[model samples]
Target: MESYKKTNKPRILNIVPISIGSGEVSLGPLYISSALKKAGFDSVVFFPDLSLIMHFPIKYDFIQHQLDYIMKQIRPEVVTFSVLSTNYNLSKSWAEYIKTNFNTTHIIFGGIHSMIEGENIIKLDYVDAVCLGEGEFSLPQYLELILNNKLTQENSLNITYKLKGKIINSKKEQVFLSLDEYPFPDREPLKYYYREGVLDSANFITGRGCPYNCFYCNAAMLNQNKGYLRFRSPGNVIDEIIEVKAKFELKKVIFSDETFTMNKNNLFKLLELYKSKVNLPFECQTRVEAINDDIAKELTNSGCESITLGIESGNEYIREKYLNRKMKNDQIIKAFHILKKYNIRTNSFNMIGLPGDTEKTIWEGIDLNIKAKVDSAACTIFMPFKKTPIFEWYQDKKLIIAEPNTNYYENIVIKHPNLSKLSLFFYSLNFNTLIKLESNKFKRMFKVFLWVKLFFLLFKGFLLKLIKNPLKLIAMNTFMKNYYGRLSVKGIIE
Candidate 1:
């Protein structure tokens, strides 16, 4: 283990663990790394691309070698991991491994998972600290104290740490009122590792925090004490986009906010600026209740290429009573119609196997997507997160089939009387198929063709599993070539 004396600047390594099926480059680590660099610290973002290492033995070895190499070479004073709920166990394992190998390095966990599970996470032997809400402000200050040997177990702002076998939580930190104060996220490190060509899009956030209280989400938990939502000025947001466009020559931008159309005034102002100054096509996600004719027109005029709306469940009872969405079916249908009228692509996000969901309700969801005529629709099985109200409800009812895991796409983790695991699996496949069928202009022929494709896809998956060694080698080669090749040509205007 390397020892560090007091130094002017300490090297910090920001690591993002790439879980299977999650390919997007997150902005949390990037923003935190940029903040640290601005405060005179040597910080670099490292993404161990494990997008393809779920079940492959050889790729597992490859990932271990890469982690060992980074720790040996970088020898960072502090190692931070940005984790999601699905990847919490994996992150914990990595933290344990790093502590065993590099005992001197301090370990900090920050992200959605750590924010909600702070008390339990801080008790872990390998974890030294957990940043509760936001890391941009808390992390730099915490690091400075460590460098100057001034850090104590006493309460600090927005940080929780352990000392003398007791956990000490800091005073609550205020949320940043102005988003313009922070520098643009450091994409230089992302450019080296992120597979930009996979989506051909760069992501930016116009704001932090959400005001809505969706039952299944953790946003309400984040806003419980800090009861405010903040947005960047329109001019400031455009300035960052201009800088990013010049640096990356990007084709598309993704406004990855909780709801991009939250503030009508701010949305219109930003749209006007984006129309005149940065005329690049962009996509965003918002709630169904937020869309209107005026908003839809402004979005289209500003080169909005696509829009995704969260129509979580089609059954009004399920949406309002269980999900707390408060959106009616008529509003969702109207929203989709408005987007279609403007010739903008529409995608609907739905969920199946929810707590109150039955076979009838699940089909209703599919029916709504079909009637909406969405260009694309995505359906994910509901996984009750730890801190959400729904998780507690399920626990009390003894409906939870197993602990939360990373398999949200293919597996069902809950046991509902009306919904079996096998039924849910087939429903997921059929839900997707129904959407594709509805999206097709030639519905009759394409429906038949799609079924054929689905059959072949299932057969191929089975064969791949049966011939494990040979198929695994082929799949690994293909994944590597596609991943690296796309990354090489990323951020280039076609």
Candidate 2:
């Protein structure tokens, strides 16, 4: 709240751009910062340890220590908190604390949860506004308008403004048209606190939104509505890689799009462009439906080192009836076979317990992973996210967040009634241990000196993990991204 005292000039802060959960950076605020800079306003994004502050079941008084330091030291006019699902309450509390302590700044909130749960959040005492949808474009304009004393816009897409304690009903905007319009991330402005490593080059996103909405999963985590599908042009995408390569001196990339190869033609074209221009290896997350012999070969030829498929369940009944994945076991086998045939590694993402998943179904999943011959497999305990179709289904079934003591994680895991909590958790952990011991890289590498091909392949195996074994995999990647491996724009080069 120390930054907004002046009504004439502009200052800005963006938070949660780097979600502590996965050590992932959200490009939303960075793009907004670029647009604000272009518009002649001083802007920068902030990456704080929200989890360090939130500190679920293992809460400590020290959680607020870092937040206290930020409030006392940093001075900015407008601060925006990117609120994810469980972060809303914690961030809102922080915003309120800032408002009460320092009156010079205005606090705002935005992100998927902010949009989906806009009304409840704005009802909070400290939140001045909620950027209801894509905030990158709308935020800059809103800030510019506020600075110019024209803070009332009725038709701007995706913003919920509060005027004098009354909420304004402004219309939302369409999803971004061109993903290529945004600027590249500059580590200098962020004070150089980022993940950079062999895996750091592994942390770039070329697109936003997903086309398909699977139940039992939070589709709204990326973007809601029919507008989740938006990607950059091949040239634009290659240019981003070149920017990172030239700036960070990296030789590989990780395409973090939900369905990295969702558009068949677009994937091929982008691969060809990368081969001709960047000549770097990369991996991506895709669905079983997108893989075929031709598509898999093109991916390999274009330097795709590996791919991860979200095989949520091996049981056909659960896939369609519960998760809405709608894929057949034959297609799943075919996809993994193609990846293996091309000598490109593969990862299978399996869910241990879901709404209708029986213990046998979960075992079928483990068996499915083995039969598919995936290079790696990840297992995750399903959580009922707020706005997913299945989330609502659970709520209707009167299965809300019953245990206030429960964190987003659990030593024992189960999403629904079929599998008991303790049983689910043990099975998930056991499956993970087996996958690790049986993993291709684990069985073949470490004792070998195949550092060349081993580098990318081994890294791919690790990248496809973490979703399941969060304690080890997530922590390792987080450290690898930031303090552990410091590529420094030099180490990534040959």
Candidate 3:
């Protein structure tokens, strides 16, 4: 491959790898693309149409055909991938395919997977560079150097690039002290795929980084030595919301922060400003320990339709001892009650397949949700992602049954002494059934019929997998959308 002289404006394409049923939009590529556009570059975001290939095996030329189409249409000189661990292999394969076929395009990988696995990622022949940590500043600077023909060195801040078969790690980039300095995310590229009636909600992040270090989380690993928490100004957040409201005609907004209510002073100030300026119904995820009467009242007063709490496990011992979530069951119940008192809906997130979990413990989780009377609940099998403390524990204990796959809802990746994979599957359905039974207001006879109907639906779902029917894919997608919508507190504000 030969280097081409810098053009007046470089064409860049950002790719986001999403699975078939993933209906939500991603912000990483949008942010990076926004920064690129702000720097006066031609940038477009591309989400590969994975609907056809998701359930089937990819032929050798399948990716080639897709890449050829995109290359001809966009003629991008720089290609960047925002990938998660689940889609890392897919992104790598695409990058390798591009390197083999294209002559002038440069490949860059970023996101959680690349940030944690940069050393191994840069070793790949297809990966030209990896952006570490946040790319809001690092990516723009890298592109500026390329546009000016000044990126001749092997290393620079917040970037790891390959040169002469040698990998070089750049100096770490300074974290942005405040998030308000950046422009709003470039959602224009997403407008290409935005369906009219499906997913009318817009998502924005008011803050970055997490204050708590749960064993299953990657926040601590990603923000080591860097500041643990950084927030945008209230005025800036409200300004973005106002812009999105006018542009997208958004029905609702979702604050996709790890813990939206982490800082009480900031939270109160933002809520006050939001009530006066935007006043749109919004939802947020927060810690169980962070909620109180005052906070819940303020959230409702500020137009918060719903709140999501991470009651990861029901057993206090398991939650605190194993998962490092220090919230007690009483606190979880109290939080739900407080939200209920304020007429705010509540959603609880639970996890079942953990190292020390048994059938009893899993049932206890369901019991906790039922007792809390949450509007909806979601339970997922535990996945030990690479670089997380839980993954380290699984590796040391030799309990890992398989590599972490892209599917977290339907797959079990660890071997428990007492829990079989089949048992886990059945237990997940049981949890769903319990949540429905607890949430709905139906007669006793209808409830029994509903239970039977749900059981058959689960059984049919299993059979669909065996036959590899396309209807199974549709059913799974529908099931996921409904499940997430229910857990999102859909009707609370409406």
Best by lDDT: 1
What lDDT tens digits, residue by residue, belong to model 2 across residues 1-494? 12223233476767662233333455556666777677666665655543443344334345566566565555667788877765655676678877887776778788777877788778777788888777667777787776666776464647778876678767554665577777665443432332323124535676777767687655445545555567788888787778667666555678877688778877888888889988888878888887788888898898889788988888989789878888888888888988999999998777765777886687678767877887777676676667778777777877554421123434332246776565555455445444433333332334244334433543454554455556655444443353113223433322
Candidate 2 similarity to native, TM-score: 0.78
Superior by lDDT: candidate 1 or candidate 3: 1
Q: How well does each candidate superpose onto the true structure, as a TM-score?
A: 0.86, 0.78, 0.85
Q: If both were scored by TM-score, which would come out higher, candidate 2 or candidate 3? A: 3
Which candidate's TM-score is highest? Answer: 1
Off by over 4 Å in 3: 1-8, 19-23, 48-68, 147-149, 193-195, 438-450, 456-494
Higher-TM-score candidate of 1 and 2: 1
lDDT tens readout by residue for model 3, 184-303: 999885453344443478888888888778888866675674663788888899899898878776778889886898889989999999899887898998998889999998999999
- Can you rank all candidates by lDDT, best first? 1, 3, 2
lDDT score for candidate 1 against the true structure: 0.77
Worst 10 residues of 2 by lDDT: 483-492
Worst 10 residues of 3 by lDDT: 49-58
Model 1 clashes, total count: 1
What would the per-residue lDDT of candidate 1 be over residues 140-256, giving only the tens digit for each residue? 999998777888876476889866677788857566546788878988774533343433567888898888888898767877766447888999999998988877757888899
